[model samples]
Target: MRWALVLALTAAYPLIVYFSLGHVEPRYLALLLLVLGGLRWLAGGAQVVQARWVALAALLLAASTALLNTSVPLKLYPVLVNAVLLIVFGLSLVRGPSAAERIARLQEPDLDARGVAYTRRVTQAWCGFFVLNGGIALVTALWASEEAWALYNGLISYVLIGTLMGGEWLLRRHLRARHARLQA
Candidate 1:
C-alpha cells in the first residue's frame, strides 16, 4: 500500500513539474518536494540513504525555488535522483555485498561464490549505467529544450531503464542455467 503511493508520486513527479512551472509558485513545488521527501522516507523504511538524499533534494529544491524561482531545479531533479542512486549502488561495493547481491539474497540467501561474483558484477554494471544515464540527464537539463528534457527524463529514460533491467534479467537467467549445468 505504501509502495503504491510512492510509485504513484514518482510517476506523477514530472507531470507535476510540467504543469506547475510558471503556472504555480515555485515555493509550492518546493513544499511539495519536501512533503514527498517525507513520504518517501517513511515509505522506504527510513533508510539512511533515502533519508539523506531526499532531505538534500528537498533542501535544494526549496533553495532553488525560493531564491532562484526558475524551472531549472525541476529540470535538475532527476539528475540529483540519479546521483543518489549511483551512490547507493556504487557505495555498497565498498561496504561489502553490493546492492545487487543484497537484493538477490532476498530470493536466494544461500548464494555461492559464483552467485556472489555475478551479483557484484551486476551491481557494477548498474553503477556504470547510472553514471551514463545521469550524465545524459544532466546534459538534457542543462542544454536541451523543455519538451525534450521532459520527454527524456519523464518517459524515454524509464524505457531505457526498463530495457536494461530486462536485458539483465535475461542474462542472469542464462548465466544461472550455465552455472547449474556446470554443477551438474
Candidate 2:
C-alpha cells in the first residue's frame, strides 16, 4: 500500500507540474516520466547489492530533478514537498534495509564482504553526485540566469548515468577477482 502511494506520487509529479504551470515542453516531461517509472519498476526487483544501490541513486536523482524543474515557486506551498522528500531520502540512507537484509529475506544469502563494501562505495558515490549537482543548481538559481538551470539538469542527468554505469562495471570486475581468489 505504501509502495503504491510512493509510486503514484512519483508518477504524478510531471502531471502536477503540467497542470500547475503549463509551460514545460511535453517531450522533456514525457522523457522524465518514462525514466522515473522505469526506475521505480527496476527498484522493486533489485536484489543484488550493486543493483539496489544504483536504483536508489536513480530514484534520488529523479526526485531532485523534479524539484529543480517544478514550476511552482518554492515559497508558495511552504516548501513542504521538498522537505518531505529530503526527509525520506535521509531516512532511507540511515535506516532502510541493506542489500544483505534483502538477500536474507530471499533465503539464498551468500554474504560477500566485498559486495557489502562495494554497495557502500556506490551509495556514497551516488550521494556525492546528488550533493554536487544540487549545489550547482542552487548556485545557478541564486546567481545565474534561470536558463542555466536547464543546462545543469542535462549535464547532471548525463554524468550521473555514466558514472553509475562505470561504477557498476568496476564493481563487477572486483567481484570476479574476489571470487577467483577464493577459488584459488
Q: What local lDDT does model 2 show for residue 18?
A: 37
Expressed as tens digits, the lDDT of each residue in 1-184 for candidate 2 is: 5356545654355335335334663334544543644554555543344334434454454455455754323211112322333443445457754432343347535646665555555555555555555556556545654445444443444566587769777876887798899999
Write down the lDDT of every candidate, Cα atoms only.
0.80, 0.48
Give lDDT: candidate 1, residue 107.
95
Candidate 2 lDDT score relative to the true structure: 0.48
Candidate 2 TM-score versus the reference: 0.46
User: lDDT (0-100) at residue 116 of candidate 2?
Assistant: 58
lDDT by residue for model 1 (1-184), tens? 8668766776677777877776887766877677666766777663666656666786777678767777777677778778888888888899988999999999999999988998899899989989998899899888998777878888988899999899999999998799789989
Query: Which ten-residue region of model 2 has the weakest summed lDDT?
Result: 72-81
